[model samples]
Target: MSQFSTPLATTPGIMLVRVGQAGCALRWDAQAACWRWPDPQGGQLYAWPAQDSMPSGVRLLESAGLIACCRSGRVLLGLGKRLGSVELPAAGQSGRPLQAQVLATIDAAEARTVISDGRTDRQGNFVFGTANTGADQRPIGSFYQYSTRHGLRRLALPVVVAARSIAFSVDGARMYFADATRGDIMQCAYDAERAKVSDVRTFASVPAPAPERGAAVVDGAGMLWSVQGGALARYDADGHPRQRIELVREPVASMAFGGPDLRQLLLLGARGGLYGLPAGVAEELAPGVADTPFDDGPAAVVDSQRPHHGD
Candidate 1:
């Protein structure tokens, strides 16, 4: 079931794409005409071909992009099959992608840690973190930045047991990250020009009962959106609570700002279901997603009805 606060009532325009187990890192692929996410339980990367079509599950290889801290698997920077130039069709057309090929593969992390949370910086370089997934959850994880030129360079920062809320400011001057058990969302000054981070401090503290949160996304207004406890909480750049809407009975598994003009707040509930609400902030268009001419997926069904998981 879903519950909405005053904020949800205020933003009545809703759009929904019925998908499930979108654990984190919801990305839009313009060339392939699909939305991509990693299934934490299934240990595979799944791609949804537009709003109304069926989802295509792509099996993971031995090594690739990583997430779902508990399990080990490969992820992706770009979605493909490596069979050479396979052009995908628009929605309702046949050639939806079922296999994901590796466009770029980076170096691996330490044996004890797993790649947990990550996102691209303002410059589009992959900035992610490793986490200690051992039973004791030791703080042996470190952050790393990867690019074609620099390859993979680890950052000089304190270790963490788990990583969440990995996001950046609009200008990429500030970075926000949190360890699942730490309760405090930390802020660090990011130097995109020099690829450095410093001035670490607490940005916001998660209260009891909602300490664990999902990955966060920054809106066009420079505010933050994260799934806290059983609802979606909004915070200002200075870390003040702006508003909160209880969309589900449990914490959300993943969320991101997608859809046309990047104004839709797409979130997957902890139990299961996908929901979208009008965010009203016209965000910066994602790489290749907006400039490239592709079929506009589908007009989502606008309503407050609870979304059900599909096959």
Candidate 2:
């Protein structure tokens, strides 16, 4: 395999994408055609489009911009020219306080590590887990599906709670996610037609349960990869980790697979850093290929929305 190495370069525009204190999630939103973030402000969402000039609230925004989820629990588009905050009529509540917003809420309370992927299903459905962050925080995170047909419907997945990571299969039929507490990746047999989830089985699990586990993505091929401890681990279709590549930096935060050719895997390391590794078809590291520089954004997101007290 051809291994490529180079000093990571810095991207100045990246810093402009900072929306929250601590940036938690980043997804390419196809609807508004921009990048989105669950801002530190509990009830608010933010977004920016690719390569737009800096906006007010954002310190260093991503070239792709930032989108925040609003106090009403609706996501606000912040990137490019798609600058407007709107509400997702379907977002519900975990009945938790706004002292710590959604990201922390997901970290403490929710079992699964989930954020909006920016794209709904063929039927326009999405699922998010609630963060439960206390000694009594249960892994039993809730799942919701949004569509015009039945509006927002919550599915009762037998709570196996852990810091969970979620992703849809290439076909969007099978749902794959990770249970960080148990260090196992799981596949939930999902019925998109009926909007039901069942047949939960362990697809893969980490050898050691790493804290602050980040996002996951499936390549053009049916492969899985995750970032932890400033390194990237590749998993086979069976959810078994085949190889782990350590990063020069510690505490890798997030990762994305993008390039003109889609051969480069872009890793978002904590402390405002980015690393590139040739993944999938470009599995061979290109010699002398330098790590891409990254700009820093927020420190940590704070929950501001009040919890649903239940009427």
Candidate 3:
């Protein structure tokens, strides 16, 4: 559609939101009313209000919740009610480490791999996968889903070298993920209750670049959007190419859809780089997809006040 061609330009009511380093896991924290992303290089979290400017400075994530990591294991900062509290330094600052509670320990098996990408499924379970950190960077990583109710359960998906673009269809029936090294994105029927998947098949073969494969997102209409090489592209529910939006510079690291209406797409990158997103609704696109917020329901949150161990 014409609207899909350039829906990410500066139309109106949309401003460029500058963010911090290797911005991975970009998502909206409804509880805090801000856009949140992780600093992949720094191992910290940064938060910026939905309407804030660069001069306003970003707030770091300081919650008593869980942010699952690779080597460090599942971090228990506290979740549930106190989801988006900010207490770290402002933007540009490295920030200090929080008093953490480790729910699980990183064993020797994970020493050669790292949880490369992760996201919350529609039913609120954290689905993440690891990538081999070996010299050759083999695709031998496994996938797992985590929740407070069932703890952490490994998925039956194939072992990907580095799992990226972990997202889910709006209805939660379809799970989307990719390993760019393998040359295409994949999907399968996901069962939240059983923590399993079926009918795994090639969803698309978009050929995204390395490292930049850290994220992708499903819009309200159940469409899949991700960085294709250096360009941003959107695909239909059946994994057909819809629109491939080019950027002045290729995507930096990752991206996510935030904002109250869920149309505000934020593109994140390394070294505080800024990217453009949909500023206003296009006439051709009509009244927008579903007008829903990017809420993954509750997440794999843990109590932050628990005893600290296995740091």
Candidate 4:
């Protein structure tokens, strides 16, 4: 395996896109042919085509924290304390107001909480993490999985102070999760069919002086791409550190591989706007992993189920 040495040259990323508000939960909507992200601060979901400066907005979700494109082509939104979906207006129908359909409301047991980061598994089940919004910054957040057959089932993991990134291996055999409070990223064996996770282990640990880690993604070659402070770090499948790509003085909140061939690395900055790096750098640093298509399965719940509150 190749190793990245210290003082690696900083390859400045270019600013390709900009959002009306700071964005998070950056994802590509293949069916819609645009990139989607939620600006919770702005209370709107925004979509922009790959080569366009004009971004369309949907004002349906209040505090739309995170977003995922469902198999049915609707957008799954994490609306603060609720899980909801909205059918995005087709091209040229941008003038109509999008309506949100609440699927589940997560109760926080008298404590303020909001759904944070989320993603779909290989089997198309939606998995999301929550964070305590109380002033105490308490470690009372939990993770849950939703499916048509199972409604919503909370996972067995320790309560986290702040849940950040969520990603899965190419084959869906492994799942990665990050807790920004502790600055630790953990990997566990994921059984997609049963919607179960096991053997939770540490994948990477970010130390002080490094900004808290955020969302992470697995490249085509199974390498993990995660944000560490102001730079993007590349890691092997097993969590060994490799190369680091320095950004243009902005902290990356999340990232995804997009573009027609899925080679472009789009980075979402915490301050606002988007950055792009040559797909070639990702390919050269982590070769052999094939692109894993986004899960576009329909988001469904048989019935509304009560979400378990963190103790």
Q: Which ten residues in a row have the lowest lDDT in candidate 3?
A: 69-78
Give one digit per residue, the lDDT tens place, for model 4 in 192-287. 656677899888765544466678888778889877665778888677777777667577778777767676677788755788776566456432
- Model 3 pairs whose backbones collide: 64-77, 64-78, 64-79, 65-77, 65-78, 65-79, 139-161
Alpha carbon deviation, residue 39, candidate 2 (Å) = 5.4
Show where candidate 4 strays beyond 4 Å.
1-5, 108-110, 208-210, 278-311
lDDT of 3 by residue, 66-128 (tens): 242221122222232222222344446754565443433322334676556666676656676
Best by TM-score: 4
Clashes of each: 4, 66, 7, 5
TM-score between model 2 and native = 0.57
| Candidate ranking (lDDT, best to worst) | 4, 3, 1, 2
* RMSD over all Cα atoms, model 1: 11.6
Regions of model 1 farther than 4 Å from truth: 1-22, 30-33, 62-110, 208-210, 278-311
The candidate, 1 or 2, that scores higher on lDDT is 1
Flag the better candidate by lDDT, 3 or 4: 4
TM-score attained by model 4: 0.87
Kindly list the per-residue Cα lDDT of model 2 for residues 181-237, writing each as its tens digit: 545566777675577887888776555534434466666666766654445566667
Give the worst 10-residue stretch by lDDT in candidate 4: 286-295
TM-score of each: 0.69, 0.57, 0.71, 0.87
Whole-model lDDT for model 3 versus the true structure?
A: 0.55
- The numbered model that scores best in lDDT is 4
